[model samples]
Structures are given as C-alpha cells and as structure tokens.
Target: MGISKHSIETLKQTLDILDVIGSVVELKKSGSNYVACCPFHDEKTPSFVVSPVKGFYHCYGCGVGGDAIKFLMEYEKLSFVESVEKIAAIMNFTLEYETSYEKKPDFALLDEVMRFYQKNLLNHKPSLDYLASRCVANSSIEKFALGYCGASFETIKFLNAKGLNKTEALEYGVIGKDSVWEYARFSDRIIFPIHSPSGKVVGFGGRTMSGANAKYINSPQSKIFNKSKLLYGYYIAKDKIYKQKKIIVCEGYLDVIMLHQAGFDYAVATLGTALTKDHLPLLAKGEPKVILSYDGDKAGINAAFKAAKILAASGKDGGVVIFANGMDPADMVANKQINELSDMFANPVPFVDFILQHIAKNYDLNNPLQKEKALAESTQFLHTLSPVLQEEYKPTLAHLLSLPIHLIGSKRLPQHNPLTFTTPTQEIAESVLIKTLLEKPEWIDFALEYIDISLFVYKRAEFTKLVANEHQDSALIALMINERIRPINDLPSLKEHLRLFITQAYTQILSQIPHYTGMNLQEKSILMKEIKTKILQLKKGELLPYVSSSTF
Candidate 1:
C-alpha cells in the first residue's frame, strides 16, 4: 500500500525544511535565508539558495527550483515515499497506520550509537594500536567514520538511554539480549558504519581487533538498510565518483579505506554480498565506469561472473580488475606495492573481456567444437544489449570469435528514428497555421470562424479543451502538462517538433470547424467529404485521384 496523502502532508509540516538539508550541506546564514554549494551540479561559487520562510530552494546555476520534498528527491536520489519517511524520522513523528510495508525506525537511535562508537575509537588504546598495526592511519579512520564497539553491555545502555528498547536495539543487530540480559554484538573490533546514501547510519561492519574467528561481523538487515543496496564508502565517495566518472569496486572495508588513503577517491565496496542491480544506478551516476576488484579466488571469480551479467544487462560500461599473483587491493596497499594496484586500476579489462577469459580458461579453445560453443555463449551475451549498442559491438564480437562480421544479422533492432517525421504535406501546412496561433492566440478566434475542427487527428482533446475554455494563450502550457506527451527534455528535438506539431494540429482543427452562416447543408456535406478524404490521404500516404467516380 502507498503512504496516505494525509501522512505525507503531516510529515511535510513536522519536518523543518532547513533542518533536513542542513544535515548534509553546511548551510550558512544569509539574511533570513541559507546558501550552500549546489550538490546537483559543480560550481566554484555557491548558486544554491534556500529560503526557510518560503520553504523552497533555487539553483541559479542549474535552474533547478523546487520545494523541500523536491530537494530531498534530487539530492538523496529517493522517491517521494522514501523522502517522506526520511523526513518523518528527523522530526520523531510516528507514521501510525500499520500496513504490510516495512516499518523503518527513527534514525535518531542509530545516530546516537554512531557517535558513541566514534568517541570510543578516540579514547580506546587497544583499538588504536590494532588500527596502527593494520596500517589504518588516524586521518583515514576519522575520514571513513571508523570506530570501535567495546566488548560489553555499555553500548546497550547508551542506546537504551536514546529511547531504544532491548527489542529495538536487537532489531538493528547492534546488540543481543537473552532473558533480560544484553551484550554488545561487536566486541573489541574496528567499526565501520554502513550509512545510507543520504548519510543516515544504517548498520555496522566490525573487524575483529583480537585477530579472532569470523574476521568480519555485519549488522543484520533492518527496516532502513538492505545489505544489497548499501555500498561501503558511498556516503563519502559519491561526489568524487560523479566528478571522476569512474568508481573502483573493491572487496572489503579495509580495501576501500586503503585505496582512499592511496589517493584513489572514487572507490566503494559491497557489504559482504555479490554485486546486485541495486548497485548499478548508484555507481552509474555521471556515467561513471565501474571496475570490479574482487579478490583472486574461485569464489571471487564466480562473484565477478555474476557481476558481469548484471553490469551488461544494465547497459553500463564496466570491467573487472584481477589482482596479479592472487593479491587483494588491501594487501597490495599495505605491502608498499600501491603503485602496482594503481596500474591495475589504470588499465582495467572490460567485463566482456574478463568473461571471455574465464570461458577460454575452462574450455579447449583449439578444438573447433569448443570454439563454436564459446562463440554461441558470447553471442547470446551480446544479444542482450540495446540495438544501438549491439550494432556498435557486433564487429568486436565477430573479431573475438574469428568469424566474418557480416554473418551476424541485425534484425532485432527497433525501427523508430526519433530524428525524422513522417507527416504529409497538407499536415505540415496545417501545422504552420497552428504554430502562428500558438505564437499569437488572438489569431485563434479569427481562424476558428473560417476553419473546421475535424481536420486534426492527434491533439483533439487539447485543442477542444482550450477552445471551450477560451484559453488559447495557454495551449502550449496545457500540452506541456499532459502526461501522455513525453517531457520536452527527454526528447532531443522536442522543442522544434512540438512547435511544428502543435501549430499544424491547431491550424487543421481550426480549418475544420465549418462557417455555417452562408453555406447550404448539401454544399457543407460535399466540403466535409473532401476534407475527410484529404485527411485520410495524408494519414495513409496515398495520392488523391484526379477526379471522383461521380465526376467521371
């Protein structure tokens, strides 16, 4: 079920617009308003202005102007419902109506827990020593929001004070309780807080400080956090990834931290799960290329293959980076071979190449039978791409398979050419008249007196609505607001095409409405038949006969 409109409005009212934005961006006081660097676009000077009084923000640079809800939608990249729920958490307002929808908790408790962990990291000596041994620098720890969860029930008490009950705490997987006894789930471990893209602390990944069993422990799935959707270091590296147009997908938290420390800013890691579609758009922002840097193991290769299928299906350019001599990025960085790691990132192989390599390793490529099988498998992979992309890559696949390129047929492509129009000559003439009306609405009434309404095929509703309302001035705006029509920005030539189409449709419709003051019924019927035949000929691309059968 969807969130009720009443609940959405209530959330809008309870959550202060300024407070929500201020958390992510460092908004400064400017008269009664606030201003910050626009997160949506890059600029040296601040063009993003927020007016708390008006409850709206306008970016002069990008020309994006909207309310708080719109701001959250654009900035966090969330849907309407997600934005409402996020705001609801900030205001401590309960969204009461129970439904099958997952119940997300207030982030206040998680925020408190993160702060506690951060403080513990600063104060604890053993945690500091452990990090030092692992070559995790002090600066890196603070930058990545790393901390330590003490091995005791003190974390439980800290969370309890923030109004989180035992059940609620356990639900987050931060603590465990058995018969009124509670203990920390993560003990003597270097903590990495898994945050949502919006920067809400969702869960934790703890590496054992004692070098004990289970090298890593992660927070169980909670309402707000899905392991598949959450990427480690995304909160920090998102902007860099956008700017660089590339992202390095490493295997572990330490791998991410090490890479970041080594001056590679655009890197993130999965939360102990294989790559999923949830990671695609997040990584694909600004058209960034992805490089999967999974460890060199049988399990890692298997994971990479799975990731390749997803990336290929998503229609994004990505590649796999196999470490030399079975070394992970973290090991390479720690062992002072950071340059080698950087080289691997610099010259990444395409995901398709990696998949083919994997196939060649298992199959006997010299055997004609094996080569044929390999080509068949690769062809199926290539066929999954869009027609445009398929055409571009077909030659490359032919080369890889050692086959003549022309042998691959291209019949699967769609036939629509968005660049061209197929309207008839009379339709173009009518369109020109409509354009004149759009440019000057006063002419609409003058044309309506002489023109009939039946000549237009499409845009009948829009024309009729405007004529009935005597709102010729708003004809363009009416069409723009219609859901049936695609957004002007989405179509490349929409502006030019819309002007032409609307003008013609308007003229044709206006020319169709009969002027009945002088015309007899029989004469009007003959004129109507001629106009209908003209429309049919125009639509079907058929030539009108020189004379009618009656005339012959």
Candidate 2:
C-alpha cells in the first residue's frame, strides 16, 4: 500500500532517529547528537553521526547521509514501504494511505490459502515420507511452514469456498491453464511459501516429488510477488542475519531450510532466478558479507562467476562458495559434511581471487592464444571496478600472469597505443614476435637490442619478464605471446615480421598523438620533424634507435 505524505511526516515526527538507529548501533552522546563507527564501511574511529532533532544520520567516512527511512532502507535492505511499515510497527502507529490501493488479493487471503496447503501436507503421507527421506525433521517442517499441494483441484476448491473466484486464483498463480482447461498451478509437490520482507506470505514455490519434466515451478509475477525482489527464507532468517551479521545465499529452498536446520540460521536463497541486482539491496542490509553457496554444476559455476562480478562491481563485500564432488548445500548437510560446510561459511573465497581463477579456468594458459584471450577478458572485467580497486588489483593480476602491471590496462594506458580501435587479428599479429622471443628466451636480448620495450605495444611486461628471466610458467608465458608457430630456422622471415610489427606500432602511436593547437610554431615544427624521422626510418627498413626505457 502507498503511504500518505502526512503519515511519513508523522512517522518521522513521532519516532526518534537516535532511538531507532541506537537499537542496532551503540551510540555515545557527542555534543547535541550521537556518534558511532559507521556501519556502511570499515573505519577505526566514530564517524557516523546521528541527530535526534533532525531525525537523520550522516556517515562522514563513507559520505552516506540520509533520513530515517533512507537509513532503514539501506541498513536493513528493506524497500521504502517495508522500512516505513517497520518504523510504524515499532512506534505502535497505524499508517494512513493517501491513495486507495486496488482491491487486490490481500495477505489475509494469502494466509488462508497457505493454511489450506499446510493442512494438505498433514494429510498427505507420501509427501511427508518424502520429506523424511530427504532428512527433513518434523520440527524443521513446522518451523519453515512447509506444505504440500496434491494433484487435484483442492486449492481452487478451497479458495472458491472462501469466496476467491477462479480469476483471482489465476491472477495469484494458484491455478494455470493448458489448451483444454485450467488446473492448480502447483500440484503433487512440496510447497514453500515465499514471504515479503515484513513476514507476510506473498507467493509460493513448488518442487515436484514425482517424475515431472519441470523440476520446479513458482508463482507468476503478481502485485504481491516478484521473485527477483524476494529471497526464500529471508523474512524468517532476518533475525539470525542481523545477529550473525552474515547471510548465506544459496540456490534452492531446501538448501536454505537445511542450512537453517543445521544451526546456520542466517541462510537465504533467491526465489527461482539467479541472484540479481534487485536482491542486492536486501542482502546488503543485514551484514557486510554475503556467501553465494551455489551447486558445483556448469550452470551453477557460470552463475557464481556472474554473481561474483555483480558483487565486486557494486563494491559489496562477499564471496562465492561452490560445493565440490557435485554436492550442493543441501547435499553437503544431508551427508553430514558439517565441518566442510562450516569451514566454507567461516572462510569464503575473496571475490577478486574467485573471479580471477574463474576467468583463468576458461582458457588453456599453456596455449598463447587462449592465455591472451583470458587475460584480455580478465582485464576488461577489472576495468569495470572503481579506480582505487582497479589499481590495487593490477599488480596482483600482473604477477599472476607473469606480465607487467602496465599490460593490465594496456588498452587504456596512454603509453601504449590504445588498442580500442585494433582488431583482434591485428593485436594477435603484433604479439607474435614477443611470443616467439619468449619461447626462445635467449633471443630476447637480440630483439630488445633492436626495439625498445616501450615500443613493443602489447605484452610489454611479459616480454620484459622473459628478457629478465623472471620466475615464470612456460605455458602461461606462451599464452601472453601469440599462439602462432614460429619458424626459428628462418631468420630472414623472423626479422621481416618483427620489422613490420614494430613499424605498425610506431605508425599507430604517431597517428594517435593529438595535434596541440596550443603549441607555438617552433614547437609544432619540432614535433612534426620528430614524427617524420620515425616514419622515414620505418620506410628505409632501418631499425629505429631505442626511444624510451621499458614500460613494465
């Protein structure tokens, strides 16, 4: 429901910001206001300031300044409406709506429908037996409010008896239609009720226990239900999440329940889709860390990579945990692998390391072509991060690839010709001479004697590393060089190729330099002469003298 402006004003007026915020953060009086260490970011000293008179907070350390609603929304990952409702509930105040909401299915009706499913589970022995077979305790079932939907029109009948017509049932996804007629949306399956952040049952997810082609089905999007915005078990797990300051994001409803039953009460899962940006706000609220516990399948692996990228780019503190031996969180718990599961939760892989390893696995680092492709792909992802994060990681990735730090951002770095306009084939050709030299490490001195390392354009760091005989892997070093075969016996052919590649690099560098209109005529003449001299040297087939020191 949409709240009125008057209700919001009254809400702020009636409640004290210090009181509400103080519940979660310990605050000491600092003059007219109170202060605490900022919850939004890491800091040693108190920087988060709160003003009871203003009814707002400002974290000078993180530059996050907002009102009570904004603070609750960010701190708890609650939606605007959810935040207001929470505050209203705390203040024992009823909210007033300015605009009338449409007469849609209310939570009372949803609650009644949930009761029908729960009753069905009680009578259905087979579903209960199935839960037992999966090691779900009776207490766990009751705590999760688990239910079953039989393969019949019982849900439709139950709702119809309570004055909810078939149209409303269809709208709520309680029923779906085929070519012939309509049937219950979920049947012959264990049902899991998905709740709103405020603890109201808004939708359902049903998993087939029999031989059904579709393993699971969820309620379609509706006024109350959006799978993207909701997390399974989140409402129930919110208290534990707040207490533990951590949340385990898994891939299935059972994974969440099993984890919770195993005493990890802060576990939650995405409704039916892979974790998306819509879920981040909710996940960010309860803690600084979120553990993505995905299955060890190909799909799960890909999803983990994507989830890692999203979390890293958004600057969220989290890690990805993929189960080994094809086991999921539920499987691990079922098999009594508590130690392994606990260890993963206790020490999740850091996000940067996880993504780098994932990208590296996609290519054969032994193969020059694949290694180059992998590094290019990895560097592109790194560029999406903030500058501070990007710089912090550059040296680490460079050291991993045995390349120069400059090469990590070679495409963006001004010293090297911007590779933005170069075709992949052109870039590969440019890297061939370097790759061949890396394979014949002794040949690096001869090549360096002729061409300056800075003018090598691509893979300058890897080239320099090879020349210096740094600790390296042959296969990874090969990938940084072009994967093309080298004819070492044909010195003339090799020299011709090297000459052409170096010429092209200089030509590109010259073309890319901007003409400075601010330069005086004498300075412009000197610049033009310098550029022409290099072109003339290239044209005369004479190797230009080393122009600058090594870039990497």
Candidate 3:
C-alpha cells in the first residue's frame, strides 16, 4: 500500500535530519551540522557531512548524497515506502495509506494454516515415506517446518473450524479458486514454508511427489509474498550468508535443504523463478559473494547465464557452477560426494568467465565470422560492467576468441563496407574471401565446397546473393565499386583461405565434441577421430571434397 502524500510531506517538513541520521551514524559536530565517515562505503577520513539546515547528507568520498529518507533506503536497504514508514513511526506520526489496506494478508491465519500443514505431514505415511527415501531426517524436516497438504477437503474444514473463510484462504493461495471453497492449491506434495526476512512464514512451496504435476509450484503472489523477491530457506541461511559473506543460489527447495543438511548452510533457492533484478536488493545486503548452482540442463545453463550477466552488470561478487551430467546438489549430497561438492563451490567459474564462455559457446571459434560476432557480443556484455571490469575482461574475451586484444572494439565495425574496414584480421580475411567470390565467380563453385554461409558475417547477405546468382543488390554494388575490390586471381591464394575456413570449421566441431553430453562414448569417439583426421589433413595443405550447407 502507498503512503498518503500529506503524511509524507508532514514528515519531510517536521522530521529532524540530525536525529534520524545520528541514530545510525556516529556523527560529531562540524560548524553547524555534523560529519562522519561515509556509511555507504569504507572511508577513514570522514568525508561524510550532514546538513541540519538543508536536511540532507552527502559523502564527498563516494559521492552518495541524500536526505534522511534516502539515507534509510541506502543504509538499511529499505524500499521508499519502508523508509517512510520507519521514520514516521519513529516520529510518532500516524501515516495514512492511499489505499485502505485495512485487511492485511491475515498473518495470524497464515500461521494457523502452516501449523495445520505441519500436523498433516506427521500423519501422512506417504509424505513421511517420501521424506525418508530422500534421506531427510525427522529433525531436519521439523526444523524447516516441512509439511504436507493432501487433497482431502481437510484444509477447508480446519480453516472453517478456526473461524477463517475463503477470502483469506484464496488471498494467500491456499485454495485454487477464490469465489468458492474448492480443492487445495497444493495436494500430494511436500510443502516447504517460505519465510520473510524477519523469519515469519509468509508463503508455501510445494514439491510434487506424484509425477503427474509440475515438479514444483510456489504460493501465488499475495499482499506480502512476492516469489521473485523471496528466497527459499533464506531465513535459515541468512546468518551463515552474513558470517561467511557468501550465498549459494540454487534451483529447487530440495537443493537448498540438501546443501544445508550437508553442512553448507549458506545456500538458498529462488521461488520457482530465475534470479531477477528485483532480487538484487536483498542480495546486496550483507555484501556477500553470490554463487549460483544449477542443474546440468539447457534451462539451467540459460538461467545461470542470465543470472551471471545480471550479477556481473550490477557489480556483485560471485560465480556460477552448472552441474555436469544430469547431477544436481541434491543428487550429489545423496550420493555422498560432499568433498567434490565443496570443491566445486570453493572454485566455481567466476561470473565474468561464465558469461564469456556462455556467449562464446553460441558461436564457432573456428569460423572467423562467428569469432567476430562472438567478440562483438562479448564486448557488448562487457560494456555493462564497471570500466575496470571492462578493461580487465577485455583480454579474457580476446583470449576466448583467439584474437589479439587490440582488435576487440578497436573501431566501430562498419555495416555496408566489404573491403574498406581495415583491421581485425577476421574482417580482413572475410573481405578478401568475399571479394574473391564476387570478382571471380568461376571460383564460387570451388569455394562453395569449403565455406559455410556463416563464414561471411560482415557481408553475409551480399555473399549469399552472389551464391544465389542475384548480382543487383546495393551492398554487392557497393562492394564492386569500392577501390579495395581487388579479388584474388590465383587458385593457390584462394585455396589458402578456403583451407583455413575448412580447418576452423573442423576444429570448432572437434572442440564441441565433449559438450555433446547426449552422445554415447563410442559415437563421440568416432566423430572426434573423424574431425581430427580432417583437421590434420587441412593443416597439411590437403583439400577435401565436401558440400558446405548454408548453416554452420
């Protein structure tokens, strides 16, 4: 609910800045106001100054300048509404809500509902058996307040007995439909209670024991519970997160529980959603290093990549660990691989490295054109980071693309030019290759056997038009009229470029062999051997006959 504007104005007009900031910061008299070390950052020289007259504070060191309300938002990590409410409460002011949030999400009713779910688990043998099978100890279950809510119309009866109604149940997502009493939102599932940062139970996460339902489902968004803003098991992990100055984010509730049970208690999971920018605020608190642990699957890898980009861009310290094979944290813990798991956590792929690798993986390093695209993508992502980070990761990006550092973002890569954009050897080779194809159409069929369409990125459409026998496009016209259109006239020089493209394509295919996790050992071994033999032949200046498809 939003606070009334008049109430906010009153607090801004009457509240004393000195009293508000002085309560948190150790301020001393400075001529007419106060001065202290900046609380937002580390500074020993006391560059932070507070002005009672202007009712604001500014730190010369970090340049974080703000008023009392802004100070609370930064220092305490509170939202604007939270900051206003906090200071208003301190001044004994009754802040009016813009919308009547008269009936808040029935906190007491939620507590009662959780207690009933816990009671239901103790009696449900199937739920208990499932827990036992997963190696979940009774103590761990009780400690986490794990529970069961079966489909028996029992939850409705119990809530009715407690004098609660459908409005509260539907408001918090206990029942599927709000208009009438119906089946529970969660049935035949193991319930994991999600808590507020203050350790109050606010919502539920259900893990389906039956394979018929989605693997997991979280409580619907409510007045107080936003899954994107809440992390599972955070209430338990917060202390360790602060102590160790690290947090391990995972994909599921069992992953967090297993990690905690395995003695790695600084682990939490997103509530059935990928980590988002909304999560950054809570993650910013305690200044902890963020580690993301995910399953070894396509979705998991994509999630980890997105999270790494966000964390890296936001300047959060962290790394990523994508479990190999089909393994996950829960599987590893159950398999008694604690040492391996700990080692993985201790030395995860750093955020910068993970991001660079993920982007590079999408393009073939052997293809000169793909390499340029890869470099451009890597540079774009790098620009989002701090300048120091951008500079630091540039060499790393260069190494990933097998290029010299000077070539990356050296100059803006031109769009319509084929031969004029000098620099970046890949572009030079591409322009040479395309000029060869355009001027000497006789060599087109010969080169078609060696090069993929992706080998000509800067002038790919022009190259495609040339291959298709349509020579009237403006881009091709521009290439033809350009002064640098001196195409290779000899077969030997053209053969040299074709050999490089062929060898790189083979090498790229070879490099991705191990990543074909779905392939059998024998099949992968045969494919690797064939690709290696072809690459070896190409390196020895031997030409192989093959039809190159449009795709690489």
Candidate 4:
C-alpha cells in the first residue's frame, strides 16, 4: 500500500551505504572500514565505523547501527517512506509505489532542445563575440555545453518544424501559448544547461546578450527543475570536487566557468539564488571543503554572511574569500590575474571566525548596550558549533568583544553527567551480552539454546528481566546508559562471542556433574562422558546446531 517491497529492496541493493553516510558525516579511511567521530553524540575520539562490504555503519561510542535507510530515518527524522523518497532523489533512482507514482521527466525533449540551442550558437556571430569579450575560451564553452537560442521568429519556426507537442512543451515550460510557435520560452538568449548530479540535463539558465539588458533567467519552476536544489555546473565539476576534496561556491555561472578555465575545475555556482538548506545535501556529498567566493560589495557580503552561518551551523569545513573592488572571479581570470585569484582562494576566513566577525560588525562594541548585544549574539552563534568547537573558539570570541573568556559560550554550557565505571571487564562483557539479547528478543531463543541463564552471574537480575521483556530494574537502566559497555556490532563477531560462551557453559557443566545429588554413579558417569566429548568437539572448532526448546 505504501512503497513496494521489491522497490525498497532494489533501493537497498543499489544504494551505496558509504556515499549515503558520507553525505552527512565526514568519514576517513582507517584500515578496512571508514571511521569518523559519531555524529549522534559528542565525543573527542572517532568510534563510528562504516563497513562498505557489509553495507551498514556502527558507532561503537553511541551504539547506533543501521544501513542507509535506517540512517536517514534517524538522522533526518523522516518516516520510512520519506527516507526512501530522499534516497531515491540522491541516487537518481525512481521509486515505484504499490498503487501509482509520479510521472518521469521528458529528458528526450530537453536533450533535443539543448542540441538545437547549441546548433544556433554556432551560427550566431554576436553570441560568439560576446563569449570572446568575456574571455570564455572555446574549450570552456564546449565543456559546459554553453549555447545560444535564436530570436523570436527563429526559435518559433524550429519547434514548429520538429512537430513538438503543444501540451508537453507548455508543461515543461519549453514554450508559451502565443500565435508564434507558442512564444518560444527561451527566446533570444544564451543558454547554460543545468544538469543533475548524474549528468542528466534537467533545466536551463538563460542569459541575455543585449547591452541594455543584463538579467539572467531560469526555466519556470516545474517538477523537473528546481533552482534551490540544483547547482549550476555541478554535473561537470563533481568528479573534480571529489578528487580535490574541495568545492568553490560563487555568485554567477561565469565565475564557475572562469574558475574552471583558470585550473580550479572544482567550482560551482548557485542558480541565481543564495545558498539554502536544501543545498546542504549536495554540499555534504564528498564532504568537500566549501569555499565561499563572493564579491566584496554589500549585497555579496550579506549573502556570504548568510552562507557562512548555514555552513558553520551545519559543521561544514572551509572559509570565505571576499573579492574586493568589484572584481569577481570572471574578471580576475579574464585579466590574467590567476596568481592573485589562486592566493585568495587558498586563504579564506574560517566559517566560525567569519560569523563572529560579521556579528560583531553589526553593533558598535564601544557602546555598553551594543557590547551587551554583541555578547548575546556571539554566544547564540557559538551554540551552533559542537562543544569541542565552541571551546576552541571561545577565546577568539572573547578577545573580539574585549570581554573575559568566562563570559563567553552559551548561557549554560553543556556538561556531561558524571559517570563511575568501576565494574570489572568480565562484568561489562556479561552485561553487554545480556543487552544484546534484550534488544533483539528473537535472538534470545537462539541464545537460550546454547548458553544457560545461570552464566549471567554478574547481571542475573538484569538478564532475568530482559528475558521477561520488562524494564523496571534500575540496573538495566544503568546498563543501557553506560557508554563504556558495547555489544559486538557485526554478525561474525556476535557468532564468535556466542561460541566462546557455549564453551564456558560446557566447562561449567563438566565440573558440576560430580556434585549431583539425584543421579546414581552410573548416571553421573554417562553425563560426564557426554560433557567431555562436547568440550573436545568445541575445542576442534566444531559448531553444534542450536535447537528450539524451552530447557535453558
């Protein structure tokens, strides 16, 4: 009735769990699995392990383990279907529902129109001259698939000859309803094809060439084209962005094209809008360092300020570079100032520093009321960062406002509850083993088949309640909250631990047989021989079949 099970399974099979997790948290290669500081909890050391082969991630510190869909549901606070919808969007996979689904986009029509525009650009002299004037190299134009659409009649006549449908054209905003071939929507402009991450052209960004007109336009908002979600030139720059581990965010398409031409191929631009929260998913991909390159003008600075807050609050690593004196990346590259541009991009103010500076600049710190206002704003901004980052930047904020470091940080800095973990390692291991069985009740049947509850010497009360599926015991509450105690994460490790417990149980049984009161000597001898044979088989690394019974 919701999402088909087959489609969900297909998504799980095709989805790359690393790429999905890597989008939200920065993962570094360590040995066989990728590791990072657990994003779910505050920790100084990295204990989150992502196993690509197993297609899941486990955080040893916080004990959160799941595949890609489970991760999205937890971190994003989405329902099962919503999480599936998000993964489908990221992977460019279509989700088929049990009843019906949304219609797919008409990419063939877009491709045909894209080719038509490219052909028109080749025959237009002014468009070519405009590119030459902007220092847009021939190679750059070809690489980005930059093209030109012809004048009013010229655009209308072509679609008419191709017999394109009127309704489909109107639905995609390809043309308007008019006497002239439905008013050719992309009339008389230079077009930059906008593509999805997988390099499928989804929409277009059109620029007017007239000296009197310097405005840019986009395809009307449709199911296929969303300006907030799509980044210009991202389809081309993605591979380079992944390789360099960096991405430059600029103001215009020309800035991206010029930056790429100047050897900074890992550059992309917002689609005529400031960066939005929707863009975070794209920025998180590859965990790239986001460099905010904008002009030093008031508008640009304000835009960068908003962008700085978003990036800093979201835990993005990178800086901001202001291109002062009205010169943008396009101008700098055209003027052959590659060295200066390179130096500027190489050194940008860190996000938190930039946010602090921007917040402080708004109020005159010399005034008492303004100084108090600045302190409040700074503290609020500091709360956006992790506790580690907040502490790291406290001194900087304090110095900026000419105040003591004690007055800095949030009104009440977060403090971890004091914990005493004096329990022995054997006790912890037993508690964790019981916790594992408690979390998955179905596994308790298998656990009982192999190991007896009497082995739960350290956590017998907790184990008893766990088997009964009750949670009233105070000891069970402490057991779950103890971060020091963690169950084995993966399947293979769980099997090995269970085998060790089985051997210990057999060993315990062998010693207890001679003390039996109800058994005759002959019966004791038979039980003793059977126990010894089982112990020897276990020593040979043989696995006994676990039976389903109630005789734990």
Which candidate has the highest TM-score of all?
4
lDDT digits (tens) for residues 319-379 of candidate 1: 8987756788877777888778777888887876677567556667778898778777776
- Tell me how far the alpha carbon of residue 156 in candidate 1 is from the true structure, in angstroms, after superposition: 2.6
Most accurate candidate by lDDT: 4
Ranking by lDDT: 4, 3, 2, 1
On a 0 to 100 scale, what is the lDDT of residue 6 in model 2?
Answer: 90
Evaluate model 2: give its lDDT. 0.74
Which 10-residue window in model 1 sums to the lowest lDDT?
543-552
- Per-candidate count of clashing residue pairs (backbone under 3 Å): 13, 1, 0, 0
Off by over 4 Å in 2: 1-105, 177-180, 410-552
TM-score of each prediction? 0.65, 0.60, 0.60, 0.71
Candidate 1, lDDT over the whole model:
0.70
Residue 460 CA displacement from its true place in model 3, Å: 68
What tens-digit string does per-residue lDDT give for candidate 2 at 154-234? Answer: 776777688866676777888887898778888888899988776888889998978799888899999668898789998
Please report how far candidate 1 places residue 453 from its true position, in Å.
Answer: 8.4
**Global lDDT of model 3:** 0.79
lDDT of 4 by residue, 24-121 (tens): 67666554466777888899667677767657677666667777888899899999899998888777788888887663646667788888899899
Show where candidate 4 strays beyond 4 Å. 1-13, 16-105, 178-181, 211-214, 411-499, 507-552
For residue 339, give model 2's deviation from the true position in Å.
1.6
Off by over 4 Å in 1: 1-105, 160-163, 336-338, 387-457, 463-552
- Let me know the TM-score candidate 4 reaches against the reference structure: 0.71
